[model samples]
Target chain A: MLENIISELEKQFQLEAVDHNSSDLVFLTIDRDHAVMAIDLLKWKFGYKHFVLLTAVDFLEEGKFQLTYILNNPDTKTDIGVRVRIDREDANMVSAHHLWPTVATYQRELKEMFGIDFPGSPRLNDPFILEGWEGTPPYRRDFDTKAFAASFYHQREGRTTNDPATYMKEKLYPNE
Target chain B: MSKKEFFPMDGDRTKYPEIKSDGTADIDLSSHKYIKLWHGPNHPGITGNMAVELTLCGDEVVEGITHVGYLHRGFEKLMERRKYIQNFPLVCRIAVPEPDYNEYNYATCIENLTGIDVPEKGMWLRTLTLEMARLQGFLMWIGGMAGAIGFGTVGQWANYCRDLVLDRFEELTGGRIYHIYILPGGVRNDIPEGFKDRMEKNLREIEGFMKDIRRAFFDNYVFKKRSVGVGYIDPAWVFDYGIVGPNARAAGFKHDIRKNYPYAKYAELDFEITTAKDSDIYTRAFLRFEELLKDIDLIRQILDKMPEKGDHISKVSNMMNLKIPAGETYVRSECTRGEYGYYLVADGSEYPRRVNVRGPSYTHGVALLEKMLVNVNIADVAQLMVSLHTYPPEIER
Candidate 1:
């Protein structure tokens, strides 16, 4: 079932890469421009009607943001994750709201959390899950959460916090 | 003269023009009437910590906008920094009412990434716990729905029944609200001695209450009149709005993660998907009631079919030094509300690279609520919101 979906997707678009990570999971990477087209093909041509999830992963060293769109077919119970890589400096992609209107909320969320721009989406720049947030997008790898917490939130004083690895080492090899 | 003299101010307004002249009395007769109203954030009718900004024309809403994030803690970022085992307790906090779905999804995702296979008894135990949690959530939903519609007694009865279920949980898991019982390899512990008998006793007690619940709540004519044809959702909008769970089932769409994409021991269970065609508050309520009954039957089947005794937790490496293989997987579970999925990315490190919770409430609470609120009667706002079963923590997270 998954193979059929993958072959159909590959036949239609020039997929940059396609890999099967595990059973019932298919990963396909395409250029940012073909994201909407690929998703439309998957939704209409293939029977993947459910828009399961949409999220972003920040790769600071690579200087790119990986946008994953997960679609599920109810009949086959298979999930196909469409991957699109956008430039970190100018993180922009076409909106999938035309296909699935609920993507507007997810796009709005990504815009707020990762600074990704979904140009044609409604309320793209609206504040979502963050009010008056004026710093680097919190989910980006470069954003220092510890530093942010120290400056903004109250921290307990006179208490030492150790890294998990350090704590594990001290506890496991106390005699050493 | 006698009636008018008794209450002079109650006469026709235009006949008695002096009443209109008073400073305190003012009436505007306009074709277009627009009043801005804020519906929540702390309102009793609100399901959780979220608000709807509604523009109403007299009694009909013109437009509605959802405002969330009153409970945002950036759980995704927080989980990314915490160790694998450290995240088990925190994931359940994402969905407060039904925490087992979150725990199961997170545990399964990690187990998938780490290549750990749970034993047969462990699978049955997880399924049992999942169904138990679903019943508890349905009980809470019944209470909330009844409360929304001015039936306070039903809420009390439902809460009492739910408390009995929680008592069983407290006995087995040692925690009432947040069990944190599901771990990566399997459940935290096996069921105690005579736990099944106690659970069956509670189930029978709930079964006894079902008849009274039907008589008082479901069979009442006032509830039917108030709920039927109210909060109508067209079947076409189900896909566009990402509706799921009982809401979609009420719309005559047979989309259930348990039946469609069976997880844990659901594949082995014998149960039918319950649905309705009305797509209104009444149908949703009916579907939840029927699903609750189905859950009871499912729990019985799980208990009967489970192995007598086996290892609940499979042997795994030390949790403190556990490192998952570098991979990404989207694991989904049939939560009480809908399809709750977790998109986990592991970079072979002590901490997760990213953990994105795809909460069903995110769509139901914000997008669908905003869309359905348009032109709806103001009286049905709370009914519509609760019928969708929106959990705000999932939305904000």
Candidate 2:
């Protein structure tokens, strides 16, 4: 089933390097323009009806936002993650709302959380899952939550800031 | 059958104007008859920390919009920053009523990414914890549904019965609400001695209450009248909106993750995928009641069949230095609400690159709620919302 999806994606989307390294997960990097088309094919032709999830992973080092659309075929019980990397400067992609209406909410959430834009979706600009008065998209790696919290909310008088990883390293592996 | 024939509207077929191609209804909400009302954030009818904005024409809701984020803690972001082990305790709080599913999903995702194999006893223990969580979640749903419709006594009864399950949980996991038992390698510890007997006794006691539950809630004429046709989800929309668990089963769509994609020793269990034909509030409630019975049986099977003496957790080299190789996986479990999936991306570092939690309520609470609320009576709004079984924290997360 996964091989069939990979070949079909290659044939239709044309000239794409796909990553199938993960078990039970297929990652296809498609052009930002063909994201909706790829998803439509997966839905109508490939029997991937379940739009499981849509999320963005920010790779600050790569200077791109990798938008992943997780689709599931109930018959095969296979999950396919379609990833499209868009320029961080121009973080925009065609919305998958036309293929699945639920994507509107997911896209709206992505827009609010990652500062991504889905121009064609309904309520694309609506405040979704987040209220007004935002500084940066909090989900992005560049947005330091600790600094933001310290500035916006109250903190203990003498409490020192500590990274969770560093704190765990010191507490758990002191001898090492 | 054609769309028009199957979905027969009351208006004249020929003379009735066609719906606009853009899918917008030509209705004016600014008229004097239309009144806007907010149904929650604090409303008892609402399930959790969320609200629905309803545009009502007299008693019928013309349009409804779900408003969330009252409980948004940015769990995904928090998980990304925290070490893998630190996330176990935090994920449980994502879903208040049923925290074990989140814990299970988180652990399973990490295990899948890290290629950590749990022992046989661990798998059985994990399954037991998941089922126990489902029982308590179903009990909470019963209470919420009954309370929503003003059936206070059943709510109290179900909550009391649920406390028995929690007592067992506290005895085993050291916490009643947030067990934090299911870890990445396996469970936190083995079931305490005499735990099986105590759990069986509790299950038998709850089973004894089943008759009264059926009589008071399921068979009550008022409940039947209020819920029979109050929130009917068309079977056609089941897959379109990605409804699962009891809601989809109640709609006659036999899609259970436990049966279809078994995880955590579910393949060894012998149970039927219970379903109902009617996709209404009543059927949804009845389906949950039926599932509670099945869950009791499942717990009994796990307790009886589990290995008597074995290691509950596989030994990890070190907690602080543990780093999963770079990989991505979507691990899901048959949560009480539905298919709760955790999409994990590891970056070969201490912290996860990204963690996206696909809670079932994200679809049920927001998209499906907004779509189903149109033309529904204002009185049945909360009833229908509770029937969908949405937890707002899951949605906001």
Candidate 3:
């Protein structure tokens, strides 16, 4: 079923079948230009109406973040994972909000977290986190977590707090 | 199939409320007819922090506005800062009422990425815990549903039974509500000595409690009248909205991930997938009734098939020493409400690069609630919320 769907998708979009392991499913990495169109076609032509998830990954070393859309077809019992790689220099893609209305909020969330621009999405301005955030997006791979946390958040001022295991050892057996 | 009949909502039509239209829909702010009522932040019927602004025309709701993110603590962003082991306790707060789901899915995602398989005995134990958690969640659902329809006695009875389940959790994990017991590699510990007998005793007590639940809740005429044709959904909407668990099952869809995906020991366990055909409040409520029985049977199966010799958890090095290879994985599980997915991105580090939770409540709260509230009466607001089982924290996360 996945092969059939991939074959059907390949006719329109520039698609490459990728390797993924979990259960019965096939993943394909597609060009960003055809991401929305391909997904719309799949949802319309095929029975893959369920938008399971929409997530983005930051690959700083590779200079790109991969955005994946996992869709499932309950009628056929087949799943398809389609991904689009957006370069860090121009992290933008046409929003799938038109085809799947549910993707609007998710796209806005991805924009806030990864700093990717979804030009067509209506709710991109809504604040999900970091009220009045300035400078860089907090979810980018290049964003240094320790530095950001130290500069922004309030830190403990006393001796370093120990973990659960260390705290148990220290409090329970003081002499030892 | 014929369309399901729903009770006519009682109320007058009013104007739109205070939500500024962001190019989606225009509101006539000049009109003085509409009254805005906020039902959120802290409310008896609502499970978590959520507010629904209803523009009422007398008793009827004209325009319903959903307000989420009151309890949003940025859990996904926080997951990026903590190590694998350090996140166990934090992720439990993602869904406060059903915290095991976050732990189980997070653990399963990491385990899938690291290629660490749990032992047979551990699998059985995890299944046992999952079923117990499902029962606890179902009882809470029943209580909340009953309370929504003014059946206060049902809430008392179901909550009383739920306390017994929480007692078992407190004995096992030292936490009544948020049991961070289901880790990635395996459970926190083996079932304690004579724990099976104790669990059996609790199940027997719950079994007796089910009788009262049927008598006071299901058998009651008032509840049936309130729930029989209320909050009707087209059965086909289950496929479109991707709803799961009892909600979809009640709508006549058999898309149980446990049966289809066969995670943990669910493949080995023999139990019926609870389903119904009415797609109304009563059928949704009845699905829970069938699920309670199935939960008991699955727990018994776990106790019978649990292996004798196997480690409860694998010995791993410190969190700093553990590193996941650079990859991405999405692991989904059948939670009490619906299908919950955890999409994680690992960059060969102790902390995940990205953790996006596809919580089920987000779908129900935003898309389904907005769609379902188009012509519903104001009185059915709490009932709709209860029947849909929307968790605001899960949505906000």
In candidate 3, stretches whose alpha carbon ends up further than 4 angstroms from where it belongs are A60-63, A88-90, A122-176, B1-6, B10-26, B317-320
- Quote the lDDT for B366 in model 3: 72
User: Could you give the candidate ranking by DockQ, starting with the highest?
Assistant: 1, 2, 3
State which docking tier applies to candidate 3.
acceptable
**What is the Cα-based lDDT of residue A158 in candidate 3?**
86
The most accurate candidate by TM-score is 2
Candidates sorted on TM-score, descending: 2, 1, 3
Top candidate on DockQ is 1
lDDT of 3 at B69: 65
In order of appearance, the predictions have TM-scores of 0.90, 0.92, 0.87
lDDT of 2 by residue, B1-397 (tens): 5544332221242322223678754445555667789998899999888999888767777778899989988898988878999998789889998899989988888888788889999999999989999998898889999999998998998998899999999998999999889887899988899999999899988998878989998999999977876677888887678787898999898889999988999999999999998788899999999999999999999999999999999988887667999878788888878899888888899999999989999999988999888767789888999999999888878
Which pairs of residues collide in candidate 1?
A: none
Model 2: residues with Cα > 4 Å off, grouped in runs: A21-23, A154-176, B1-22, B25-30
lDDT of 1 by residue, A44-159 (tens): 97878889889998777789899999998877778899999999999999999989889999999999999999887888888878889998998888899889989998877897
RMSD of each: 9.8, 7.7, 6.2
For model 2, give the RMSD to the true fold: 7.7
Model 1: per-residue lDDT, tens digit, B1-397?
A: 3644432222243421123432222223243456678999898789989999887756766568899999998888888888999998789899998999889999998898888989988999999999999999999999999999899999999999999999989997999999999988889889888988999999999998888999999999999877877777889988788888888989998888898888899999998888899788889998999999999999999989999889898998898778998878998887778889999988888989888999889999988998777657788899889999989999878
